[model samples]
Target: MTRQFTGCLLSRQWRDVAGGVAIDLWFATAEEPLCAHVTGEQSVFFLSADQWPQAEVLLAGERGFTSSEPGLRDFSRRPVRALYFPAHRQAREAARRLLEAGLEPLEADLNPADRYLMERFITGAATLEGTVERAGGHLVMRSPRLRPADYRPALRIASIDIETAMAGLELYSIAVHGTGPGGAEERRVFLRGPGTGQAEVQAFPTDREVLTAFLTWLAAFDPDVITGWNVINFDLRFLQRLADRLGVPLKLGRDGRPPHWRPLDDDGERHALQVTGRLVIDGPEWLRAAFYRFESFALDNVAKELLGEGKLLHGPERGEEIGRLFREDRERLVDYNLRDCELVSWILEKTGLIQFCLARSNLTGLAADRSGGSVAAFDFLYLPRLHRRGFVAPVAASTAPDAPGGFVLDSRPGLYRHVLVLDFKSLYPSIIRTFNIDPLGLVLAADPALPEGASVPGFRGVRFAREGHLLPDLIERLWAQRDAAKAADDAPLSQAIKIIMNAFYGVLGSPGCRFFDPRLATSITLRGHEILNRTRDRIEAAGHTVIYGDTDSVFVWIEEAEDDPAAEAVGRELERTLNAWWRETLAAEFSVESRLELEFETHYRRFLMPTVRGSEKGSKKRYAGLVADDNGDDRLVFKGLENVRSDWTRLARQVQEELYGRIFRDEPWQDWLRAEVAAVRAGERDDQLVYRKRLRRRLDDYQRNVPPHVQAARLAV
Candidate 1:
């Protein structure tokens, strides 16, 4: 029988087959999972027609051969001759050989599977038309023709948590809270033997039985997305190890395939699990990628912060306590396990993290489960469009660029009153919009045929064309969408858009990106330097004392202001005049309408740009201020201070906070300082004196200069 189906592309892979490359795709449909097999697709890349002769000799023994045509053209309008391969391996081999032979191969770095979908504009959603066949008692769509489809199905999600003892490599319990088909809620726990839990618990006779039961339950539930707090590194890894020890095949995939574990390249520090037809999302990683900030990312802490609830035990002995609960209070242990699952699910729902991931994937063609794909996302969105615009992206540069950092002015140190902070809204993105600083524009400006007045002049011998560029328009659209998202109070979507916009310059600067060029990134940043310095000058000339300036903000000191209202008025006036100055300046000089928007960000009633520890020089990025909140309550804000540094002990931070608070409030701080000193001398501050620092490297790797944390880690090990 033949049929048509639509679903989200859950997973995709390709392998070399007998005749050609076979594409294996897994889709999550509303009713059921669909396995599709596509055959006879060849792997391909492009090269210049002149370079084909050398390429043929380089790839002599390769099974795949080049295409019999020279059709595509590159950015320089050079003809991009076609090269095809029978399989992915041959394509990769040919690319390596061509590179070794000093031939430039365009778009050869893309994965075969990705090239297949992205070339056809297929992102996460897909549709298929195929003939049905029976394979090993399961239905398979044979030789399916796939296309990009708009799919927004309600996905089935599972919140999973597991408890185990690391010392013995023992599996204690596997708890899952998920929604089944038809929106039915399912909660179950597969525990090891000797557990007298409630009806939701299924006790297993052995370790192997526990793993088996968990897999069976997972298959039965068949969740589209599995979410957990560190599930990949901890829970799934434990399950895989347990299954290996018991010599049992842990079939966790949608179609009873064993979970494929790919250890991360970070020296086995992280792992990624590929479950066919499902997404495995880690809560902590996903939240971090979405720019979620918390004092602590621990499951209990995050749950308490977000949902007003936390783990069963909030004490420091959680690990020991979980094991204790398992031995003495099995019912309580089961409840705790199930509560964790519920909390993770609730967190995901409240944060709208999944929604943001889907939105980002749809926008950038990245996998929904992928994290930290800033460069990849930028390339995905820009490359296809660039190709259509007659540009083949340049290969990654071998060396890193020496781009100037953001402009930071020398702060006039000392505590002052009524300081107004005026900030340029989205400065780099605004600069791109106004000046048209873009990669393609750089190329266009260099063309001799272009008119002298057709481009805007940039710093360090850079110029951008007046028309037909990519980044400025892309940023403008994203900026508008972000504003809309902010107006609608959609924090996740707003944050995702903000991160993408902010990463454009960085991606261009990064040597890892294919379009990396010093000129492209330097133009944006150096233009920013000019804008900031000139804005400060304009503000200072407007009869206000410019105390300090950073990349996009200027701090103006107003004399004898009694309250926030007066300071705010001064800020608004400065913002208006500076924006007008920039508008007139850019229009008169470059004939480009300014998109620079100077926004009044803060009215600090009492502000302090602190000095270096023992010197009179003011700190670069550290400051503190007193401001009034929306409710008219006075609040103290600290930046780049010991109060915000995690490496500082709690006692030190507390001392700084109390000292600063007293000073800012005009209260006597000498007595408070004396009392703190007395407490420290009397050993009453011992608990707060423990310094906590993150160990960023392996203990063994710290050879020449071992920090205290490294020593501590070594001791612990």
Candidate 2:
């Protein structure tokens, strides 16, 4: 009996069946997890109809059928026919064959699951219908017709941590901090041996028993999202090895399926994991994608930064301490393990990273667990609209030469007061909107019949149609949505929107994107260059000395600085004048409404624009400033200087901070410098003298002699 159910897509997989491809889509409904099986759907790709004679000869025995009639057309406007295969594997094999035979195959790179849902416009939330049955406490349906549905379900999450030997092969303990149905919090630590701790510790006699018990607990909790710090590369990988040693399955997935692991590279330094019915997101990766920054991504450091607390054992001997606790102090070990787990959970909640992930997925139609797919996100939002505008998606390739980047003006190095910084708000997006710069618009404007004044002229022989463009309108909508998100104080949604909007330029520039043309990227960036230069000119023409400019900001140095309020008034006036100038200028010149907005970003009382080392020429992208805090206390801020560099020693940073602060504040520093030198000579700065440098290349790869870190690694080895 056919039935219908509504839910959000949780996971998807596919396999070859007897008759056709079998697609398994798991959904998270309000009641329970539902498994929908859409069968009898063949994998498909498009080919030009003229190539059918050669294709049939090449794919004679393939388990598929070629359409008798043409269905679609390639970007070149050649009529294309569809080829349906019994399974995804056959379709991929046929595509490879066709490629080897030098025939163009369209839409062959799309995943079957993605193709199916995108064709139906069923992103994330959808309704599934047909042949319903009850299976394993969840509803199961077969051959379901999916329709778009607005299903947003609350997801259960678990933060997992594991303690292991220094070699990272032996399992010491596994701890889970989970929130399940009804928001009930669950905490458990499966220690390998008999122990006692403040945490809820379940002791087992052997590693195998502990592993089995942990798996059981995980199944019982059944979290939709499993997260940890470097969980896949370390903890989960070790657990899987342990399970294999004990001849047991690592059944962490909801449907009794084991976690699948694939090495991200041939070196096996990193790996990615996929759970059958859950999203296993690495906390640090997700946080970085959300633009979170810290001194280090180490759990202890992150926890300390975000939650004002570190691990139970935080010190130089942390690794040795863990082993010692495991031997003599089991309770401490359990506490440490459980604290790590809970810290991950706390960090996730504090940052609202999960919400950001969901918002990103909702906005881009990508899975929540996917990372750094700016190009894919652009395609998901752009391709369908392009097709609707009577254009097929082009193949991924760079069609034009490289383009110049944003304009960075040479700085006038000096220390000055009342320096105001003016910035263009979302400069590239605004330029795109103002100029109607788009791939389709570029094509339309290039028509021979298009009159000279019919389209807006751009840099490098590019012209954009006045109408029938999509990106400008698309970005306008996103811009408004971002404003709404900001108004609602939805940081996650706001950030997601901002990221997506910013990715448009990058997507157009990337050769991996199907829409990539140097013209499209060049238009945006060159337009930016022009705008920044013209704005700087206008500011200079307005009787202000523009000391520095970079990409989208201009630093105006006001002479004989008054007070902070006077400086702020000057900035506001400058901003208003520049905006008015842009509005009138664009209206007069291009006959276009200007979206250019210059915002008053910062007022640095004592700003320093340093020159290049050992040269009189000024630097670009490096500066320092002093600003007053809310309590009227002066704070020294550094950019691209030793004070902010990670590789610099603590002693160097401290000395710079002290020297710069004293100089900026007009305080005497000779006595202080002498005292610091004496302390250094007396070995009082021993701890601060150690240099922490990142080895960006492998030890063996550094054939051009060795750096300090490489030498240290050699000495350690």
Candidate 3:
């Protein structure tokens, strides 16, 4: 019987069956987990029809291989044919043979499971209709027909943290804290000990017992997401090693399968972890993916910053402290272990990072736990649309020409009053939409059959087809959805859309993406350059002095405005006038509707465009300003300055903030500066003189031009 169900995709993988490969897509619904077992699908790649004769001759004797005309053309506009094989390995072998014969196989590098989902245009949420049967604690759907759906699953999350011996060779305890289905709270700690008196703490005789008990508890809880601070690289990795040593299988997957670990680099220093039906989301990784920055990504630091609470123990001596607690204070160790788990849970909850990850997955068709996959995300969103448009992208180029970046005008160094900032909203994306910049559009515009007036000019002798583009329409839809999300106060969805939209330019410019083309990237950036220059000219023509401009924002000195309201009125007027001018100008010049939006972003009562440290020339990105807060109190803002940089000393940041604040307010700063110098001379602020920096390489690796941090590290060594 065919039954329908809606669920959110959690994980997907493919395995070799008897005669072919079968894709397993795990999903989480409101009531239970389900695995969609899809088979009878051929692994395929495309080749130019011109090369099809040679490819067919090369693979003539191969069994389970077939070829067909898919009616698709490559980016070069050459017709392409599809080569299908029964399994991925055979397809890979065939592509290797073609490559060895000096022929190109397009898109053969894509994972089979990813290709399956991307071809179907199914991202995260999906509705499945197929024959279903109950397996062990879950359902398995055979050959499910999947379609995209508007569903978001409320995932059961478990945040786990483990305690280890000082040598990191022995596991001391494991703590888990999270909510199960229906929001029921659960907390438990498995301790390897001879003594225990704390509630929710289960004591076992040995490390193997503790590990086994924790795995059993995890299976019973059945969490859809498993998260922790540095979980994959530290805790999970350590547990995997311990389990191997103890001759016990670490079964953390919902399907009673062991976690799969793969080294990310040649050195094996980092690993990627995947479970059958769960996402292993490391807290710091997801936080950075969401653009959250902190001076330190340590659990204690993040917890304190986000939750106003931290671990019971901190600092460099934490390892020794944990050992002592394990030996003498087992109960305290339990508390500490559980506290760390709870802190990770609270931090993720406070930041809404899980929701943000899910939102990104739903938008880009990437996995919910995947991070830093801008190229893959672009492929996930673009390839399906391209295929539907009767085209296929070539493989990523081995090399791509450099593309220009955003425009940054030289600054006019000065301390001025009533400076207003005007910015282009989503400048790159707006450029893409207004100018019809796209990979397929660029290809189509060069066709001899294309009408001259049906294309618009781009940089570097390239043109884009006006009505044959896909990216502009995609961005327009995302823009509208973002607006709706903002109206509904859906911050996660809004942020996800913004990140994806902004990443388009970079993806096109990146040599790692299959659609990489310098012409497409330069078209957007150079267009931005043109827009900023024209905007600056217009602002200056409107009787305001253009102070500084960077990328998408322009700072104007409204000297004639007497107060904040007057300056704001000028800004609003200029915004409206400039936006209207752009609309009319683009329509007249290029015959395209302008999506360019000039927004009045901020009005600083006092603003400063600083000069270079050792030169009279003004700096481009360095600036400071004083603005009014919501309560009408003055607030200081800094950019590209010591006060906002983590590598600078605390003393430098403190003095810079104080000096800038006093100067902006027109207060007596000379005396304050003298007092601060005197205090520094007297060693009153010695603690603030210390600099904190993270080393990116080994100490011995810095043989030339060693930085201060490297010098300090060598000394410590």
Candidate 4:
């Protein structure tokens, strides 16, 4: 039987055998390989179908398993989801695809003999996933009508996370949250590990009574939802194992409830963490929704980015800090754990993730724990409503994408050119407001343009199209009231409206949301692309240059009629007056119902959008905007906060800024590159070069190809 998993691939440990490699995959559950045989020579990777090359793949066995694969690993030892690619050749291709997906690809180039042995099991692509008859003596093939993301989930949500000792020996804490902004307090409970009772906040005398007191408290807070970060793989497993060893019931959560806590059977056997409850919401899995590309989602790093505050404890001795919190200082631990709870709450609020979770639940008919796709969500919501005297949701028409290689344009700095860049802030939300696009309404009314709070039209057999679809009615009312609030200038009401509007888009786009309809999303984005392009053309036709645009922002270059100051002033004034005319003209012409704000962003006297160092893609979102003063002096700034990013050491920013600053100001450069290189080699300003890079994950994963920071982490560990 074929097994499937969603996970990250780690390093390959090569043994003395000719073709054997110990591959590690970080899986979401504790699963063994689909086939029991573990080949010595194998390639490993994470589970994602998008990265796999379906064409080059000769065997289904070798193609990386997406979640849709036939079998699932049991939820227990949730390590890297292990997959064995017997030979290195197939693994190499899989590795390349993984690299494209933004993972650090690992390859083990073993001897050729192992490569040959691994090829025996290679199974290529299926002959046809879907077939169509050919009228002209040819057969066309396609995959199944993939409602690419149709999984909507039920909203009985539980946000769970775990805290454990660094030694991986003891469970220090376990917290489960509810669907509300607060984790658990709303309708859930948090269970403290044995260490919680001795917390410094209350200053209990002995460690022995602390664990018992915490358990007693747990007996009171009975819960259905169990949550945590890798709680199944680590936290709950350790706690249950410890309880078994001590011959005690793992009386966990509120009300000292007794649900059998099993002991660890053997190596690779499923453990306590795998025990299922009503639902378990992994904080990390949910966090993946945000798409924040940062190294390691450590508690400290995540807290700082989302909450603006982290645990007061700092330094290389975090393990020691954990010990101190439990042993020497219970108060600090309470503060720390409570702060983590708050951060989780803040993240949920910022993303409206729980709302999506609930929305997904309502759409997919799946429980909260099941991750659903957009197509699944849409189908779930649309089909039942259709069945009650209804119709099927239109399956996405598979077609070629718009060809790449669209030309990128640039706007160079001209003499005193007063360029007015017009921007549409939150265009999608506005479009939703004007168009009456509500996902809930689509589910209920299924109408192209439903009015605000309009009763969903009654279905042939179903009722309440009259009352309105739940989500759409909710959104329509929210949008209408938001508009009212905005008009009335009620700050709090306006905020609520904005929240609901933003949440609509996220729900439409989110895979876990029930209304994850691509049509809903496409309707918004395609319109946006059209608006941006049309706006540019409108400006250009009016005798002004629309130099560049990205999404909602448009950059313009005011034609400099002359080089001298007197002539430049005349040109700038003309540019500003023309901008006002364009704004009014767009409003009068199209009933698109949108507003644009023009800002005089920069006075770049000289600029360069150099092609990316390795590729011909003219480096976009990377450029210099500079201006010169009367005394042959200049100052420069980078477009993308290039100066502050920690990876961009002091070297590049200073050199680029100085070079442009002088060039823009009519200052002649003589041998500038030489001086800059010498300065760097001499270590004249080395402190500026000392970069503190963040380690994104645990240090063990980097055992093979060690980055400088990874090496630093190893030393620290």
Candidate 3 whole-model C-alpha lDDT, 0 to 1: 0.91
lDDT of 4 by residue, 342-396 (tens): 5665565665554444333422333344442334333433333332332222223
* Cα lDDT tens digits for candidate 1, 1-717: 788889777777778888888887777776577878878888877888788888877777776575755455665657777788888888888888789889988888887677777777777778888897766444579878888875756678999899887477888899999965466888899899776748799998788888888887777777889889999998888778788888998787776788887888758868877887788889999999887776578899899989999988766578888888878998998999999999998898888887777666656678888888888888777777676676677777788758887899889999999998888888988988999988878877888899978998887787888887888988988899889989989776687788888888888888888877787778888888988888888877777788888988888899856776887888888878888888899889889999999999998888999899999998888999999999988889988998888788888888888888889889998987998899899999999998777777767789999988788778876
The all-Cα superposition gives candidate 1 an RMSD in Å to the true structure of 2.8
Report the lDDT tens digits of candidate 2 across residue range 1-717: 877778777787778889888878888777777888777888877788788889989988765565555445555656677788888888998989998998877767777777777767676678877887887756788777788875556688899999988884678899999976577899899998776845488888899889889888888877888999898888888888888888999998778989878888888877877787787878999999999876578888899989999888876678888998999999888888888988998898899887788777767778778889898877777766776675656668835577778889889998888899999998999999999998888877877788878799887788999898999998999999899989999898899999989889888888888878888898899888888889888888878899999889999998856789988888999999889999999999999999988999988888889999999889988888988888889999888898888778889989999898888888999999999999999999999988777676678888888888889877876
Give, for candidate 1, the lowest lDDT window spanning 10 residues.
68-77
Candidate 3: worst-modelled 10 consecutive residues by lDDT? 178-187
Runs in model 4 deviating more than 4 A are 1-164, 171-212, 218-297, 301-309, 324-389, 393-419, 424-531, 559-611, 614-618, 623-717
lDDT values of the candidates? 0.83, 0.84, 0.91, 0.45
Candidate 3 matches the true fold with a TM-score of 0.98
Question: What is candidate 3's lDDT per residue for 1-717, written digit by digit as tens?
Answer: 888899988999897677788999999887689999888878899999999999989999887898899999998889999999998988999999999999999999887899999989899889999999998878999989999986767789999999998775788999999786567888899988775877798989899999999899999888999999999999999999999999999998888999999999887879998899998899999999999988788889888888889998898789999999999998889899999999998888899988898889999999999998999998998899999999988888889789999999989998999999999999999999999999989999999999989999999999999986999999999999999999999898999999999999999999988888899999999999999999999989988989889999999999899888889999999999999999999999999999999999998999989899999899988999999999999999999899989899899999999999989988999988999999999999999998889987767778878998888878875
TM values, all candidates: 0.93, 0.94, 0.98, 0.46
Position 185, candidate 2: lDDT: 92
> In model 2, which regions exceed 4 Å deviation?
1-8, 48-53, 68-73, 124-132, 141-154, 181-183, 197-199, 398-400, 449-454, 630-633, 696-701
**Total clashing residue pairs per candidate?**
0, 0, 0, 65
| Deviation of model 3 at 213, angstroms | 1.0
